[model samples]
Target: MSFASHHNASEKGEFDKPSRKKPMFPVNDRLRAYLKHHGREVKLPVAYRDLQRFTYSVPLKDKDGKDSLWETVVYDLKEWEFIREGLVKIYAILKTEGDLTFTKHLDVARIDYCAFGNSQPFRIRIVNKFNDNYDHYYIKIADASRVYGLELEHILSPNRITFLTHQQTLVEEHIPGIPGDIFIKTYLQDKETNRIRLAKEFVKFNERCFVRLLGDMRSYNFVVDITPDIEDFQYRIRAIDFDQQSYEGRKNLYLPQFFKENYPLVALTLEYLNKDSIEQYQTEERTMMAFRLASARYRMKELLDIMGKDNISTPEKIGQLSKELSDYHLKNPGLLRCHSMGQLVKQHLKVCLRKNLLLIPRLQSRFED
Candidate 1:
């Protein structure tokens, strides 16, 4: 399954510039109420703003001596003590539903800040005093689009996310997996790798992103969760960054396989899967998403209601996406009625899943004959 035939492996240039710099959309009252109803709202002792008071910082490196793009921040002694305690409490809330009994044995091992992202998140490492076990969590400024992305991932995707939001701070449990870029660089070329399985997973992952209108799934923005099975291994690609969820104007931005950094996986798909198989996987993904939508119908409707009224993107971007979708699905007039990204996504799900569901019975009948 060598992909040497796919010579154009540098498609990253096509996506050189996304539509625009994403403005941080505020969490309005309606969205806040939805979060509260869903139990995603909580009171945190420390906010994202409080973590910015670090007195000094030193660059952090990986085991191989490469700069990790993170800095280990240090605070004044008095401020350190207070922030450390608050961090422990925050971890408790994230991991144990605000149970304070476990705080005594936990210590804040380190606080690292990432200066690269839009959120500038602080990564907190919590270590157990008795056994020295450690885990990581993140604190970032709460953006409405990110929150919506997290909620959609929680409800629609197979992965379950644990996060809590306060006024301006968001605490999230660290999703554990090997980053996609690192995996592709190190493991994709290995002889024993399951190319078919990996390619299948990537197809489904691509479909999931497009169906939900989650944008900007560059190689680094996602991770590959590899689980060893009895006979082989299973790989699931999950998006770790959600900053571009439903915000981009270009329709292809929502599809990860279009990104040049992901060309290797795209090449693998071309080598391992046929056109029919790819469409089958995409339909399978849409069917599962439709089922999730059915189960969470009320909550999904409420969330979309709020999102429809919110201004998460510019009017021009919304108009462009709506028109693109309308033209893409020329047979379905529902797309032309969409006035916002949220509405467009809702209609997309309805039209795609309905078509797939209808095709199933006809295909079954053909097989029976």
Candidate 2:
């Protein structure tokens, strides 16, 4: 299947205020209390400062001729809720409405340091100008979000993602960490050793994501956190982007199938640079890694069937797509090489086995009247 096309546009003017439809979830007080009490309870000892009620007097108007203003209360968290536990910021949008969106001025790795990197966060606002209609209003807003999400996801590591809110023009949590591209390009140098390690992790992560039916793994939607002083750049990864994550059955967007049929080939090509017969060092543990990757693919298929029954593409289409994807990989051997022909066959067999195993359970589970 062809990848969808994307368009990037210049950033828009600053929002004067949020729209009325975008009320700060009335749970504001309770959320803060939870953060206050639970923030200290968590292993991560970062402080959560409530910045709500802070006047964000951007120019905002409403459907009514009456004047309305956008207001926001934000919070800054000094570290990740997950790994690395370094300096980070999470802003809670107290309120917003109309065309509210955000754009990044820096890559994920340098996001936390945007202030230091001479990059300013870009804000896009939809105005209630008499000239624009409702349809035009939404079109501008959605296009802006798409560009922001895709571009941002590109700069993040495999496991890192960013959080955003349009209701209050919120760009929550500027995470401080390494970009995924940098990690892939620099740290994952020993072709076979790191390739297999990364593949296993990718499979596992994709499986979990598919089970939940999350859609669209954009390249730059995440950020990686490295230990303050690493001996050799060893660091844990956490996924940050959740904007595209949700239980949308209508799309049949399973995590596993997408990777196997779409992502793996491209991802492997990018990671391995089409290296041939690279040594699988002791650290590689090829067989075990392969198993994990296969398992992830299997889990993904099962998850998809569970989440997307009526919405899934026809069996014929699914088979056609799988074959097409496999053929695509084989045709571009130089760009998508497996260690050897034998290894390629073995890997594909594993994928098939995993896919079948997942399908059997799903079919049986559903057929059981």
Task: Residues 179-273, candidate 2: write the lDDT tens digits.
Answer: 55545555555542345445444444443433332344433333445544333333443444433433122222433224222343235533543
lDDT per model, in order?
0.84, 0.30
lDDT of 1 at 112: 98
Question: Which residue pairs clash in candidate 1?
Answer: 12-260
| TM-score top scorer | 1
Q: State the local distance difference test value for candidate 1.
A: 0.84
lDDT tens digits, residue span 222-292, model 1 = 99999999789999999999888889877777878777788889889998998788888887888888677
- Location of the lowest summed lDDT over 10 successive residues in candidate 1: 1-10
TM-scores of the models, in the given order? 0.92, 0.30
